[model samples]
Target: MAETGAPRRQSLGFLLLYALAWAGGAMAYVPFLTILLPARMTALVGVSDVEYLGYVTFCGAVAASLAGIAFGWLSDVTRNRRGWIAAGLVLTILLLLAVPLAKDVWTLIGIILLWQLALNMVLSPLAAWAGDCVPDEQKGLLGGLIALSPALGAWSGAIATTPGLVSVDGRLAVVAGLVLLAVTPVLLFGRPRPFPELTAPPPVCADGDVAARPRGPAVRMWLARLLVQIAEAALFAYLYFWFRSIDPAMQDNEKARLFSVALTLAVPVALLAGRWADRRDRPFLPLVIGASVSAMGLVGMALAGDAGMAKASYLIFGIATTVFLSLHSGQTLRILPRSDRRGRDLGVFNLTNTVPSLIMPWLTISLVPGFGFETLFLLLAALAAGAVLLLATLPRGR
Candidate 1:
């Protein structure tokens, strides 16, 4: 996958629409998975909501993983990304509407499972679609732009959860509407110019063995992302609890606000960093630096004595990890296993996101309860450091 002809650049319109559409995918999932599903289960089951919610989440993750791989492969085989993405958007919205209609816990779980499949039908193809279109020259800025997804996702969560603003079913409708607004424009108007070389040129390994590149450094990048993701999953689950352990008087909204701010800051910070990466032609640098800073933030967390330092440290870790993940999203496209199978390979890479949820719970159960968050933070810091090491070994791309 050598660089061939000059880079083909798309207009800002396609880029923005593509990023919005990407963010819209997050809008579809983040609120439903993080907020609506739990709330709905609680409404149905009262005090025993956790049992049902757990069943739904576990099954949904499995469903998403399988659907991501399968649909991604299908898109690659057929060479049709927009068609799948459009179909997925329709199915996803329909499933969102179906969510509120479920009467029983099992029925809700069934909807969630199908919803997961439909959501990936949108996400997996959409992700591959980027690879099909955006050139390497602009991928860094694309990374920056699409960083808005999680922030937007978190914002939608806030809107949905606002007290007395809307009824529960209305909240789902709002989510559906937002998804439509974000995605439909891209399908209707977007015109991405495909990159010439879909798979990037293989990188020289740290030991100067090109054989060790593993299909253009995709394996190392994937593994590094997995390590960082494991740390992120643990923190996402337990950050508030750790904050509570620091100060028992804190309220949930306060923690939520902190998370919102951190996510918001990531946008501008990532934009600058990503644009810098693109101009310098060193796309992977931010990921390495972000991981290192994330480790330092974890160390700060391990040692902070009071809520002030803890919150500040959390902001640091949160911003860094968010930026790292977002930039990685775009950069990963540059190093896919193969152009022809980009979507399917991306599905394999999506394991970094889902597998962490499965692994983090066991990790937290083993460490945090008995040893405290200090130990957990230290361990996570090491993991982030490991990511830095892996990233540093990859060949620096021009």
Candidate 2:
């Protein structure tokens, strides 16, 4: 992508606001999908709850994918990032409020489809807004800051599900309120640059030069991300089951705590790694290292015969995966081909996030059920290694 010129460096305040906005976008869905929605599923269909939840999740992912692209393209067409983000925030909150009204599975699924669409409305423009405002020199640090999104998302989920704190509808309201509180500041007081016209020239790098990133590197980055994402998705879906196989005494909350620990610890890791990338002007290097380490963690998991060993290995994989994802989100903006289409292209890149959900289930079913989790972990390690290879193949540049 050709930038208009070198990028305009944003202040620390703007970057934090931008990161919080992205975190808010993540908060919009993570809780509902992880805690609240599953609770609703259990209430509605006790025996086959997960089956129905999977259907809802699959449908929601589809809606999110389409909506991400559509809203991003619309923002590009309208050159109104804040407007789209605001509209999306309102719609998402409304949909969250509507969740309590659905008593049936299909009804809840329908509401979730709408919710996913609305959530992406906020996310797509918000992501593209970073490209518009944040300079390449700071993008790595931006990724580090963006890592707070998932930690906060998990924390929000903890609040929503805290015992005796709230009822089902109450949880939905709390989530909506939290979203509103977190997102409004960015919309009302923040001063991010407006999205430029569709014909805007290529994006500028931070060092007073037009970015020279080509489609080829971006394409490789996309594939590499997809491969690592597959591994992450697999572990997310099956960590509990795999742990249970190691020790039948392990409880769900144990794994829950593990998940929280992984996400929380990864935030600082992402921050440190991002800052290092910024200082070094080598964005892909962290990704390559993260992927390689993640592969090693997977292999460790594959060989772990004890619960303690498994948890330790999973922690390694989890931290590396989370850091990789956070950094990739920021760096993707750097490599994306055009300023005009950054949002739309980011939407395309988001497929790496959703497509893995579709693929991981079938892959896990095919492997874990028959060959056992050892086989599954090994295969996931292969995918992580493949990510490392793809990232390694990228021509060395910032």
Stretch of 10 with least lDDT, candidate 2: 192-201
Cα lDDT of model 2 by residue, 1-398, tens digit: 23468554567777788778888876777677656776688788886765675577578778888988899889988889999999999999999999889988889889988888889999999988888877777888999998888777767777776667887579889888888888888888887554344246766778987764468988898999999988887775456456767998965345556777787899999999999998888888999999998999999999998888888998898888889999999888878887877789989998898788777777776776579889988998999998888887675556
Clashing pairs in 1: none
Q: Supply candidate 2's per-residue lDDT for 193.
A: 50
lDDT of 1 by residue, 226-252 (tens): 999989877765564577789989754
**Candidate number achieving the greatest lDDT relative to the actual structure:** 1
TM-score of each: 0.87, 0.88
What is the Cα-based TM-score of model 2?
0.88
In model 2, state the lDDT of residue 74.
91
Model 1: weakest 10-residue lDDT segment is 194-203
